[model samples]
Target: MQKSVVVLAVLAALAVLSSAARAATDAPAELDLLLRGGTVYTGDSNEPVVGDVGIVGDRIVFAGRKAPAQFSARRTIDATGMVVAPGFIDAHTHANADLHSTDPRKRLNIPFLTQGVTTAVIGNDGFGGFDIAAQTQRLRSAPVGTNVAMYVGFGPVRIDQLGEANRAPTPEQLDAMRQHVSRAMCDGALGLSTGLFYPPQNFSKTEEVIELAKVAARHGGLYDSHIRDESMYNIGLKGSIEEVIRIGHEARLPVHVAHIKALGVDVQGQSGDIIRRIEKERAAGLDITADHYPWTASSTRFSAALVPPWAVDGGREAMLKRFDDAAVQERLRTGMRENLRLRGGPETILFSAGSTKYVGKTLADVAKASSADPVDAAIAVLRDGDLMIASFNQSDEDVRAFMKRPWVMTSSDSSLGHPRAYGTFARKYDQYVVKEHTISLGQFIRSSSSLTADTLGLKQRGHLRPGYYADVVVFDPARYAAKATYTQPALLSEGVVTVLVNGRLAVDAGKPTGVGAGQPLLRTPKAGSCT
Candidate 1:
């Protein structure tokens, strides 16, 4: 009897031990995935550092300090020594071209993901191509490395309704344009963007823009503009700014200035005045916002650099005819000289998407070799291709000044144009935030993630909170840097190890896992934005 009692006591002790162990490691019921380790900047001022983030289905349920007791997940990621923040939000992009021209997801998204960007806003500078329904349909069907939002092309809308004439639309045409805008918004455009600096859009006046913006506003969308002037041209610097501010007031819609800049050494130190205008307006509750790339060089088409807008009035065929005309050619050269001065110098210019042979060469070199004037060299390149070039016109002082503002946010100003498109986020971290120490890690994270997501009204995103979307990035902060340059724009960024979009692993273990798990960010009626 004594021996039997001893064995029973031992067995009871064993059962108790097992029960205690289970209590300590019990799984939570709501989690499909769990991320544990390092530090999490939740973007929530309250509980920024959470030990574990619990995911249920697609959304996060718990993100505070905890171990799973009643819950179990199909997968758990050990994210020790990583900073999991919201995915970087690109404020402006031409990636819309990417979706239509090719399978958007099949390309090298590694450069973007490696820098922790999971969402890119496409359609800027007033141009998004035809066939909206088909494009959105493909975006939904195929899947992509990041969430993509689109904007309707104001330039195309103008062209489709009215040719490239320098006049306001007729009352009937205006109504038709409104209908087109309505259809585009219905077809899932987040807002409207106008490249007013370009030909067709430049022809439009401020009143017309206000009218178009009213259409966007009615559908709960914002108006974003590549302003009519970035230099001391016909409208002048102050005039261009007033245009946007006036639109905000006149149309009662949010206005976003796309790639805001005061181009040329002539206006180098005038950014402060622009900032003051924005601040004054913002304080008055005017919905105004802007974004800037970290680099000093601005990138765009070569045709824009050479030919006068008037000559390009009839589109490519007419423009080419004028290009062949000697008198028009003289006018083009004169315009190029004036424009080139606005763009710093030829050496500061770096060619991007063009004949690969001309990619890194400057206008000076190309001009010298071709035995032609630099302007003529640029025109020739454009004749062969609508080559994208990066003009280094921005000042370091101005960039730093812009960064100092709480209102100014970071942007790549990058399209699939070149290094900026791929290397923007990495460049921000490596060049400005870490290497230069211009901003803290928290500031950098906020600028790239939460601040950006908030601007777009991404509910429950851009934070490391429980019940938030599981869009996360893991990277070593110290080693992060951009590798791509004018010479090689396709080079992937370094230091990012893992990236998740809506609980799906688009990038994992420093490699793309072949997941197209991004979701469309629909426009909320009250919080309209540029897609």
Candidate 2:
């Protein structure tokens, strides 16, 4: 009787296991979207494979060599003759201000969308905002149209606490600044960013920055900076790079150099040296990375880039007084001449925006038109208000050299009056990867996507994998190219057929679908665990 009971129990258990297997095989994959017939280039891989991607409710449910037989979706996009890859992420940007516009059309960020970017890291140059919580809340209250990750800017914090004073922060004031960083990190800011090259932040000493960086480090955040000097300015290029490395080492955090460049005649051909130093630091176990735009020209306001920092000290009123004082005029002229020379002369600086008549004219042309010294012409333009200039100061060779480094990623450093704002990524892909062959397509995608995500400590958003957020791009490789030029800065790029952010279509059939599918990405201290 006992033997009979044991045999009966074993038979029952086998029947139950068979039923469970049947249920698993018979169930349908309830996918919301399916992209079929495409060459999938997973950002982490060096090769592409033909496959289908299945998405359901803001997450990828399936991505493999073949589509799951039982999977079906409400919408299916035919991706024939296209390469589907993870969405591009811009490591540095100034589009936060533009996205904050009251107009929804402007907020959609069509320029970025057409270039296949779904995410952008903003608040660069240490001017993101002082109150990061309020800034994020404002962004969340409206439709941002694209994914945004913000940084706590040290510049605004200094301005708020010290009122543009050019002195070392007192201990109490330094603690107050630390509090600001802590608050920002708690409020979901990605990290702390400093524009040590700009006012207020430039006034701060390295010790003060190190302490502030510690606060971000404790929260597992990054230290991103526009270094104090990129050329022949105070501290020099190598000194500035060393300063960043010192901070990262002391603070125990990752350091990201914004728009890494070899600017001016003084720093040309120094890319090899820069790479060696960075590699040495990495070998010593320091986490250092950098981003660069593809353009030889860098855009900035005339006052900030050309005017002597001493002239701008104490604020705009003081600078204006010095600009007008007869005694100081010669001194200013002497300084401006040197500045113009360091920036490759007046011929290299082009007026990109602000004054209609001066637009597209070089500084040399503008100086000649006014019959004034180029310095005087620049001062006149600045006197009207801040004006934009696209300074052609970098070497193409240097740009390519820095780009090939494994630690560097792509960034637009995008703002108004520059073609880079619209065409940076597409231009990199077309001009550098396709035409120049500086890096392979896989390397380009990796640098533009997964590498950025890893540097930023972003979780599950930069790869095309099951269980990851569905931020995807599909483009025709042969057709992908940048249309925007210096003369036509707002023109849209071509070849991106579709872009999905968080499983929602932002760009459909090469055009914006008018959907605001962006969410503010908040970084927590435990974010790395998710990675």
> Which has the greatest TM-score?
2
Local accuracy of candidate 2 as per-residue lDDT tens digits, 80-113: 7798999999999999876888888888888898
All models: lDDT?
0.74, 0.86
TM agreement with the true structure for every prediction: 0.89, 0.94
How many Å off is the CA of 520 in candidate 1? Answer: 1.9
* Model 1 alpha-carbon drift over 4 Å, by segment: 1-27, 46-50, 64-72, 101-108, 129-132, 326-330, 526-531
Model 2, C-alpha of 163: deviation from truth (Å): 1.5
Q: Kindly report the root-mean-square deviation of model 2 from the true structure over all alpha carbons.
A: 6.7
lDDT of 2 at 198: 88
The TM-score of predicted model 1 comes to 0.89
Q: What is the Cα-based lDDT of residue 387 in candidate 2?
A: 78
Supply candidate 2's per-residue lDDT for 212. 89
